[model samples]
Target: MKLPIKIALFLMALLSVMAACTNKNASQRATQTNTDKRYSYEYVKKISVTQPKKALQVLQHAEEHKLMSPIDINILRSKVYYNSMLDYKKATFYAEAALNDSDINNRPEQLMSLLYLAALEYYNCGNYAKCLNMADRAITTGYKYDNRRLVGQVLTTMGQCHSEIGNVGHAINCFDRSIIIFKGEVKKSPNWNLYYALTTSNALKANAYLEMKQYKELFQMKPEYEGTLNKLNTLPEGISGVNDLANATFYSIYAIGYEEMGNHAQGSALYDKLIVTRAANTPEGATFVVPYLMLTKHYNEALSKVNEMESVWTRSGKDTIDYNYIHNILANKAKTLQAMGRYKESLETGIRAYDLNDSLNRRIKAQNALRVSEQLGKKMLKKHIERQETLLRINHIANIVIGALLVICIGLMIIGFRINKKLKAKNQAASTLVKELLLYKKQLMDHLAADEANNAKNNRKTLEANDDKQQQYDEFLRMEKMVIDRGLFLQPKLERSDVAKEMGISTSHFNELFARFSDQSFTNFINDLRMEHAAKLLKDKSNYTIEAIANECGVPIRQTFYRLFSKKFGMTPAEYRNVVADE
Candidate 1:
């Protein structure tokens, strides 16, 4: 296993060069030093998801005062935009700058990671040529560094770019290579993420095979990926988006494959699984719902879903939404409306879809993108220093040694990237605590439903209340649990009538049942259900942002969710989560 003498000598000389450069430029690390580690990676990551503006401001301040090394500042900026803001253009810009900077150009591993980010952002922006170009460079960097993880990662993105452009053969080749690399790495160290990566590669490969109607390859994929998922299920807590990514990758293809094979029953069953998962909560996975809605003739829900998707993309957010996907959704809406015999409506929708298609083609072909001004940040950073009000925040930002920012950045490349979410990790699995909580929620609902049904009927009908005629109050509550079990409580406009219909009771009778038997009013009852679910969601460690949690709990307006949650639980959602974590 020894390297040839020339290769060995070259590696030694390379190390010597790197060491010399580190010593030479070590003093040139920071321009103006931060006395208080305010712009540290740890601090930025803490605020990145929930308070993106604050995180960005802190980063600007750090850069303004020369608080961090140049490379560190830009890298953090890239990741915050990429992961939190979902703004791909700014992410791509910063990532490209970081790679080209004198501080990071010699660091192969960091280069590998940054290259992947830039390529992913390009793909997001629908710049296929640029995406492929970045991926090619990333692949080369991965090989140069002998980083199997990076190589596998970039190949997955590369394959996706090909798949997007209809180059199925090339896509399949890239996917297969990525899968092989991932599988080999998994054998060395088994983890859910690696398995997830393998599953993603397989899923993309399966899609390509399905497109070509190569059922044989597709058939082989089912067992292998299912087995991979089984192994993943046994592993411990992963980073945010495991459940979502799993559904979007393996289960999505599984459903589509069943549909393609004409086994509508099996496909429908899998489709239901997606509805229960967090698939609809995300833009990428939300598209999967449309096909099932169309198949089931749930035209109204399908239209609502399309509009919701459109709103999500067009909202006052900096993130780039894929117009190509939006066009597809529009086309699906037109078809759904046609099926429902809404001829005039369908014609208007079809026109919109066609116009969007033309617009998308122009975008993809032209790939016009705004540049992130490198100078604006410098000016803003310096201007904001006099106004900086940071007193303390030690565990994260405080621990980042300000004077040793460059050295710290280098050390973090080994371990801090995982924490920064830039490093990704050795191979973490979904945490056991997260698994237990998820299972507890599902099992708790199912268990309580049966237990309460039996108790409501056999044990106690009324709680010795005044003016209580024999009401099915217990029964009303039981059926409400059914509504929540079906995730209907997450509906913002869900009315009392909706639950009454589900319960096979009259709306007036439903109101009386709550009025007589329950201490809280009907509205309070619904809010309580949402509040309890919000608590569970907060406890569940994942990428459930405050906004996402509010939306998930049938409260889209952040202020409303906060107000109702405070009334129900004495503390804000953020405080409640902290309390639980402390416990």
Candidate 2:
């Protein structure tokens, strides 16, 4: 059953060539790095809904354009290649790419790249042991690297990997550690990662409790979990300007948690809310539609919504990631069709869902596989270091035993020592590079701080300017009060000459002075003062109807009430009164 040697070698040669073609330069890698920060999750989610070819093109564009940083790009490239395309070989390529260049001077970013690549490899191969091993490396590296949040994230991922592989005790341990870390740091902020991490840890904890039949404890966790979710919901909509995937995920998880706690009605309501929110925010034909998956039971309605969403996206050029939405709805449609005895239609819809799932699995696998491969590479490096040390010891022993060989060995040893010295120099050089990078990072941070300080100063100056303007308004008020003391604007049909007489000035000089001081014509100023007083009188609901208030304030025309009120307050007198009543 073995292939002939010639054919086998030829196939291997072809693969090697293909691999070489996909290897990218740093700029191309940089594009992926930037995109990773912004779009990695969206790409993964999109895999469930979009065609593999289209997803591949998206990754290619990022790579070709050099839109992201190298480490970020490698993480994303590995993920997109592995998960969406199911190209394990390319996934391995990018994971290794990420690992090789992951030294960011800052330990946190380096560990993050390592963590991503490790997880990608493990999940793709469905190798839970290796996944945990990689995740362990990430957790350990995070500890060594002093990034508590990354450590928590790794622990959560480790828990999920164990849960998948049926290692309940280990999963519980991982989840417990993750919860401790999250409680220590993640609770203080509204980070989306923190929310998801918390959800995963709680979900795992609840599952463990469920397994132990500790129903009371499981029930108790429900309210705390829901409270966390409520806090998440109330957070100011983030400035990211896209639908908040983390919030949507919270609702989805809460739906599960609530249903398990014997709150089916609440669970269903959450699901409905998730669906509505997603529909409103999601773009058409864009691949992120995880929220829509819950509505599978309502297949016809879901498909209609999907079509509507697709139409909107198409018209507006928006991307939609809804693979699960498509699969779940189509599956439901197939089942409904089958129940109605329409086997052919059922088969057709089922086939569509099946095909879509294949695409989804490919994308997930690609990203996961890269994660696993990166972990293995780190283990290999650790092993290589150990082996080198052992060899050096063996050579030292050999040199002592052979005296004639000792002289030549001593010279060789001197040369080897010199080479080691040079390598140390290179290591120092690397450290220098790291220092320079850190200094540059500090400069950028300082610049940002300075810019912010400048902005604050400018804002304060603007406030002072506004206060000056308000002071001018106050002066106008004082002048109006003096005129009021002399009984201007009191007549039922107030005239400018009456106002001038009240102030004891000629009409011409009175008009000029009033206009110069108040920045309004005398006639206009008098009418406005009358209107302002009339509006205040109208607000005294017990004493004054609109007509009575208008008469008392010396503006007797009832129709004028409508015009003046609308101009001054943006609503009619009746409407304003109704608004007050509601308040």
Candidate 3:
């Protein structure tokens, strides 16, 4: 009886302990839930443009405490940096982090936002192809989710990319589509976002028209642009909350349009407004350099104003200057200097601008090569998978065939496998050769730049010792040597017109240079290089046939090759080979 009573008391004590443990867990869970809610609210809703620094502190605190979703935090961080601080690199980093997060794989809305932001950052970086690719992805995702606003934004960005690349027609089409979508969204709900999109789209369209020299279209759009500007002004300050750089761009385009339409007074007034309203120390004010340039082209005090603006830009620090933007600034500065009769300074600035432009072009080409390689890799992977599936199917059929007709099937399969192996080996070798060729081409381009610079220096010394006519003759000789050294004549379709364009000289000038220097026409000069290369190849006892060597030397027809070789070298290709053998 005493044992049973002890067991009952022990059971009651055990149940009481269990109840206390459950209550503690419940309280802890409630506290965690409340903390999560608070963090989410503070990071996502309570944060404002005016309080980005404080918002960043809250974000850091939340991150420290491991509250809220990581993707959510990253997205917010990207927005804060992009919208408030205008730090595109940091913004892109966070946006890309959000994109690469596994947590957002199934969340289309979040993924779409990250993609659109990434596209914008790429556009800012001047990676137009990557920008277009990301914009396309975002547009597809947005359409799948039936999100019109996201689609409109991506389309607008796509338009900007096209505009940057000088695709005016495609740019106009994209802008129109985005404007239509934004108009529809506004019709449903009159929001500041939609209004901003509409205004920016129309402004970009006008800018495109300006680029295409469609003055009639630009004039037609002027009244509409004015009306939109008026409406935009009526909105509360920062209500649209769009990119201030873009806002400044819209105003600049408006002013440019007025100037193009011969309203110099109105254009001047608008320029004054832009200069005063957008402080020169700001990013938006960096765009003011455009108007100042235009003003300098027409007005008198513009040079002093541009100088002041340059001081402001320098004070803002070099980190604030974007690569492409600075290139434009230097170009405009050079032009302004020329207008002010500062020829030496203008020439130096122009050379700097040209060098920067060339660097940017080379970078763009390298990026394009990388992109193409990636796409080819994907295609090759897909083809490989398909080939594997096909081989498996073939193997299955071969097994069946072997059972039905053993002897015949065995022979057929052996032959088929051998052929397949040979083809694969050949393809692999071809691919490797192609890759090596691309590498060689890139190396050749680098060597070409260095050679051009060296040649320029040599020619400058030559010029110092020569008269103006003699200097021109020397320059032509240097250019001709460059063309021959690069083997440009090996291009079968290379023409005098093309070479003239490459040299940045008129066709008539090219002809005059050739006549004065070589005493031979351009055709004879090209033929001479081909004959020289052919002679060298023939002497080397290369495996190439006469016709093949001729083709390689840019003479396609065998008869024509013989005629040119006999005329230039005093013998046929075979006779040249015989003489080379005797030597």
Candidate 4:
């Protein structure tokens, strides 16, 4: 009887404890129901770099179910695209969309962060102007909000842009300011990004000195290689890829350690390990060991390293291939070859570098031309809209005045119609020009193979000395090949008359010879050559800007270049360059 009572009491006690725990869990669940799943962003961030598609699906699910607001969804989308997908333009779009959201209005820190992200993406897309504009907003917001770390981040990107655009002095200033901010802010609030920013600014400032050839100043900046690594080691393992980032950021800072202090083999080993991370693949992150190798008189090692570097570099995907960086590599190879007393190979490598550089310049020109035309188009549209609005207002006011104003209003309408008709005709004429240029461009582009086949046959043709007319015709053909090969037709004011004079013949004779020898007229032939040259320049972009490339191709800027270039390429020059840049 005593044992049964004890067992019953124990059972009752267990039931009471179980009921209390259930009520506690119920209370916790009720509490969680009221709060949004903002902490769920951690899962998204963790998986984004490796499983972007999955991360996107999660974001979509949260968004469609209204579990998260548009501001959260947009920012997450932007972060995913920016960090993982490597789509800067798309990232910028989402980031800006989030920035404009009303929910972001009350959140100063979030707004500043998104602005910085947008600015960074713009810089990635090579739109330094837009980047700077966005950076200005971010800097202002950060300063106002007293987010010193965020301000430092913005300055670093600004400095990078300045360095790229050849504003070395300004770049250094920005870097210095960023470094100061990072140093002070990190002390107050230590974090992964802040520490990394501090290190990056320091390296960049040193690199700026390297660019200016101020080696003494660079060397004076302490914490060479190992010290840089030690600084990086302060970052905790709580952050993903922190270890890789540290090693990559400090790469080759050891091999030379400013001037000289390490072995080429050791640097090579470090490079192989460091390059596994994408951080080291950037132009700024590349190994600076080749110079050190050369300094140590390791010519063979330098040459081998150059070859290896290029092989790995080209495999880094097309988007990562900076023309200037590639051109620099080639130039270095040329120098290394010359140092080894291989003059012929050095010359060949040097020529390749020059050709790449020239290509880069042409791409820059086309981009500029595209930008100018776009601006003009926007201005024209704005003015047209304004003029129509003005006309409507004037007509409305005139109707209230008198019947005499009716005739004037009608007259104004007639004038507007006539103006519209003229504009239409002008547009039609421009369209016709584009069509003709495309037709010629197509013909020339297709002729490369045929020209190569005919090349051998033309030189092999037997000349009959007894027939003066035949000899003169053959001589004209021979001289034409030389002229074309030497790119003499590239002169802006080149004319058939000039070519005839150079060929020691009259204009009539030159015309006759040209018609008999080729299917194209002088104008068509020259235009085709120019188009071909333009395409070549656009394609070989290694390290050039998007400027008015066809300016030097002897095409008129307003009438011919941009219109024809857009039609031929099926996209505006800037759009095409952006696509290539993205690739």
Candidate 1, lDDT over the whole model: 0.64
Q: In model 2, which regions exceed 4 Å deviation? A: 1-69, 76-93, 102-108, 120-130, 168-173, 187-196, 203-219, 233-243, 256-264, 279-583
Per-residue lDDT tens digits of candidate 4, residues 1-583? 0111111111111111111111222343334332554325545655665566788998898877766557767877887776655555567779878987887876666677777777777665556776798889988987896767777777877887887788989988998897788778668866554565666667667656766766567667745435644756776633355445445545544334433443457656665555566544434232444655676677997787677656665665533224433344677788889999999999998877777765654454455445455656876556645754785588678767767678788999999999977755554555455446656755654564465456546543343323777666556655566556667778777888888877777999888788777786777677767765665565566455434567757775645766766665555555555444444
List lDDT for all candidates, in order.
0.64, 0.53, 0.64, 0.61
Q: What residue pairs are clashing in model 3?
A: none
Q: What is the C-alpha RMSD of each candidate to the true structure, in Å?
A: 28.8, 33.7, 26.6, 26.0
Per-residue lDDT of model 1, residues 1-583, tens digit only:
0001111111111111111112123344433355464565545544554466787888888778767777766766776666555566677778777877976766666666677777777676666767788889988987886778778877877777776677888989998898899899889977655776676666667767867777778888788878876776676624333435455445555676677688889888887776776645555344666665665677888778777765665674532234433345566667778988998999997777666665654454333321212434655554433223231233237546654797777887867555645311211122234336556767867777787666566644344552444336546557767877777787889888988888788999888777767787767878888887887888775477989999888899999999998786556777666555645
TM-score of 2: 0.40
lDDT of 3 by residue, 324-398 (tens): 334435655676788878899889988876676656655545545554556578776566457557856886898
Q: Estimate each model's TM-score.
A: 0.51, 0.40, 0.51, 0.45
Measured with C-alpha atoms, the lDDT of residue 451 in candidate 2 is: 51
Model 3: worst 10 consecutive residues (lDDT sum): 1-10
lDDT of 2 at 570: 55
For candidate 1, what is the TM-score?
Answer: 0.51
Higher lDDT: candidate 3 or 4?
3
Task: Tell me the number of clashing residue pairs for each predicted model.
Answer: 10, 48, 0, 16
How much is the lDDT of residue 552 in candidate 2? Answer: 71
